[model samples]
Target: MKIKLLVVGNTTDSLLKSLILNYKKRIKRYVNFEITELNIFKFRKIILTFSNQIIRLFIVEQLYRDFTIINNHPCHNQ
Candidate 1:
């Protein structure tokens, strides 16, 4: 299976980006991994369009202080 890491905005910090790339390289050795950076507008558009089909979303705060797991069910709308 392929794992995709999607970010709503660009990572401006050089150190953080380098660290992320290093981890990405290591992860690629075990599985197909990719990082996609999308602008806020496009990201929101995708979420609105696919909200009903999305099963779960894992979100991490900017400071990495906290994270959230959102679960969605199609039947919930019925």
Candidate 2:
């Protein structure tokens, strides 16, 4: 079983990369990290799924970098 860690970025840079890497290290035990470009203006509807779990939805912010979080599910795996 493998969990998915979604990291979205409105615009990516060094900071965003670092953020993803940092969070990835913490989350590596359970999930595989992936990053995607997003629209800052309409991030509210962006749904993040972790191993099929919708961890975040409808997040609104002027994001210039990345979004990071820690999550665990029943399917959390290596």
Candidate 3:
């Protein structure tokens, strides 16, 4: 089985990437795990239009899990 993670923005921080990679490596021990980072700068235009299909593909490809994590910030609105 293949597990794919579609991250919305490019991770510019090295520390963040390292942490994510560490988790991904741990996940790989039990399954085929992969991360696909979609850069907002490069794909911002197409993302809005293609987002639906992208999610659909993710679900159709294998067992689906959607986890959204949001950090609290002074200016953040949710």
Candidate 4:
């Protein structure tokens, strides 16, 4: 399965961006990972447009702080 990360805001800190990019690259080796960054306004627009799909699972960053753990999951290898 493909994972799409929808970030509502951009990270202005270069160090943070670099860290995120590094993790993204590592995650890509195990699964089809993607990160989509959108400003607050655009994110709000999307929320309004896709209100019907509100039931979908939305994993917040705080909950998945260590996303790299996916590399250890055997199911993702498929």
Where does model 3 exceed 4 Å of error? 40-78
What's each prediction's TM-score?
0.52, 0.31, 0.49, 0.53
For residues 6-78, write the lDDT of model 3, one tens digit per residue.
7665555555556556656645655687888666577344433344434434442223222112222222123
| Best-first order by lDDT | 4, 3, 1, 2
The CA lDDT of each predicted structure is 0.46, 0.38, 0.50, 0.52
Full-model lDDT, candidate 3: 0.50
Please, what are the lDDT tens digits per residue for candidate 4 over residues 1-78? 688888665555555566567656666665687888757685354433232222122232322334545434334234
lDDT of 2 by residue, 38-69 (tens): 45746366543342222222121111112222
User: Ten-residue segment with the worst summed lDDT in candidate 2?
Assistant: 56-65
- Cα RMSD (angstroms) for every candidate in the order listed: 13.2, 12.0, 11.5, 9.2
Error of 1 at 33 (Å): 0.2
Q: Residue 49: error of model 1 in Å?
A: 26
Global lDDT for candidate 4?
A: 0.52
Worst 10 residues of 3 by lDDT: 64-73
Superposed Cα deviation of residue 15, candidate 1 (Å): 0.3
Cα lDDT over the full model 1:
0.46
- How high is the lDDT of residue 14 in model 1? 58
